[model samples]
Target: MFPFYFGYFDPTYIMLIPAILFSLYAQSRISSTFSRYLQVRSYKGITGAEAARIILDRNGLYDVPIEVIRGHLTDHYDPSRKVLRLSEDVYYGNSIASIGVAAHEAGHALQHQSGYAPLSIRNSLVPVVNIGSNLSWVFIILGFFMGFSAFINLGIWLFSGAVIFQLITLPVEYNASSRAIKQLEENYIIDDDEVRGARKVLDAAALTYVAATLMAVSQLLRLLIITRDSRD
Candidate 1:
């Protein structure tokens, strides 16, 4: 199916080149923006952990524990555990990027507190998305080897969970960024200039999610096209 998917068009590699290049460009831009923000010191000089704490407190979510995990950009919110895990850099650094990222995670805590619809939906999808992401490729490969249409269809359905998760995640991420920026401004955690830097960092990070969603959708479309052509 993989080969069949690409074999239908003349110079199929050419069609993929643009998508690959665009994905790369998006990733590069996101990285560059994050790097730039990481260099900019927050005007208030608050550490990332402190910023997260403040945001959570402001949202009446003082119960959410913030912890430093050893990794780079591995920061995330665990809804099930009611914890915000920050990377080593984000937990300790006072850079705009660190604070912005921390604040965004805290926004998730706030979302949980407020019962935000998108965040709720995203949390609901986590289990299925995890299973789907891990098993979809395996099923796809097995289906191809066995020439089993049922297995292939099942793989497609499983993979679709990942695509749905990506789509649902876009709003969750964007809203988190929006909440982060607003909280920063409202609490005076960052000055005007620093807020601008934080905005850049959050915006750049959001693009990464957008890129992932687009890539997933592209692959799903390719699979559908291949499945259709196979029938003919």
Candidate 2:
């Protein structure tokens, strides 16, 4: 009998396997999609930084600063700093993938400007998620060993904040990608073929987020079941 392989059959880890596999697949898909589209130059020849500038300026968001950051797929709009940071590749790329990603960040900027509800809520939950992420498992382990129902419940409650945040994030992410595609089409940033390619990239990127949410849900469920069994 294989000892490590038997871990998969354990109830606690059983629910986790699907999410882990999905996460791996989604990551691979996004990487492949980005790599494929990165080589396909857009007809407009607009760099990602340029695309972000155009989208922001078009929407009267000229004050938002764009900073070039290092790393792959690290592009993000920092609402607190009023800065849109693009990864080295995205910042300099003049391809469909670049424009698509830039436009997606621009959409987030627009959401901040317009006071998008879900984005605001997600931002509010950030601190709680950070603190809870650090302490949730500790409380769970302590409570289980100490036979303290209160501690176990508190741990589950803390982790639930992260799950809720992830659920809200799905809409925020999906909407951003949708807005990016619409802006790309209306503004003629990409031709039909390029748009299709960009969409594919965004779609693949979106799946990664979905995978993350699934992973969190799985963990929360595992904790809940453990706590319930302990109580019984």
Candidate 3:
């Protein structure tokens, strides 16, 4: 039974193949898309930090500070800190890709300001999911070895929180990108042609989140199928 569920040749592994492939594709797509647009400078000539500042101020989030962090593409907004962080490439570069990524982070700040429901929910799940996701497999494995279905069910329930967190993240991310595009357009931060380029970069970024959600759901399904089979 352990071999059936946990061994290298476990059949349940097949369920994750599609999601794994998609995750790889999403990573490559974002890399290539960002690299391609990184070469194309925006007509506005403002740095990514400047672009983010403009958006934040426009939305009356003038108190939120933007910080430059050392990384490749690690731009994000921290609602708790009320800060926006951008990687070196995004914070200093004047390329369309840079501005787009910065705007996306600013969009997240906007979400925080507007009390977006999905963002609120995702944030609330962060602590619980962090703990549950890590220990869920332990419980499942322990239950199987001890012949305790209750432990297995508890593990599944805990793992389900991670899946729910991932699902909620989809809308939160999508809304941020949408807000980014809208802010860029409405503010005339980038030209019309540049908008398309920025949108391509953002759309590619969004795919990574989609791939993650699919992978999480596939994992949950695999666990459910395995548990049912073991019961029979």
Candidate 4:
């Protein structure tokens, strides 16, 4: 069963090598760009927390709180509790990258407050996507090995949720960056020249997500190929 499903463990299935290399390249580029932006201090020298506060205030969302979390680039917005959590570096750093990231999270808060449809759909899919991502691969592998076509199809359906989730995430991220850039310009958080750096940082980061989704799609395609070859 295993041999039939996995093509006798051929070394040539190593196309994954290129995919891995691309993923690493994307991650490194994003990190490097963000680090460079982090070194360029904003003209206002406003810390990330302060930047977030000002953005929220501008949008009339004064009650949403900002907290410093302990991680590198592990910042996110919590819609359930209405909080913007930033990494320690971003929370206190007075850098273009820091302010951009802070405002991005604040943008999520604004989206939540403004009833953004994409964000709302993303929030709704979180639980289903989480469960599907965990179970899909296991079912696909097991079903392929055991020659259970039903299980293979079920796995495909489940994995589709993850793909959809990744696709949906793109707009949420892009819109947040848009909001951040506009806020930065309007509030004078960064000058027109400096805004280009912020855009680069955010754009590089967005590419990582794009890379991830492509990887997932690639894997699913590989699985389909394997399943087709096995049937013969």
Q: What is model 2's C-alpha RMSD?
A: 3.0
Q: Candidates' TM-scores?
A: 0.92, 0.94, 0.96, 0.92
- Residue 191 lDDT in model 1? 87
Put down candidate 2 lDDT per residue, 1-232, tens digits, no spaces.
1112213443676788899999999999999999999998988789999988988988899999999998999999999998999998899999888888999999899899999999999999999999997788788767866888888788888889889989999999999998888888887777877888889989999999999999999988887776676567
Q: Which regions of candidate 2 deviate over 4 angstroms?
A: 1-10
Instruction: Using TM-score, rank the candidates from best to worst.
Output: 3, 2, 1, 4
* Overall local distance difference test of candidate 4: 0.86
Pairs with steric clashes in candidate 4: none
Q: Which lDDT tens digits does candidate 4 get at residues 148-225? A: 988888888898888888888999999999999999899887789988988898888888888888777766666677
| Model 1, span 48-82: residue lDDT tens | 99999999987788788999999778999999999
Error of 3 at 58 (Å): 0.9
Each prediction's whole-model lDDT (CA): 0.85, 0.87, 0.93, 0.86
Where model 1 places Cα greater than 4 Å from the true spot, the runs are 1-16
**Candidate 3 weakest ten by summed lDDT:** 1-10
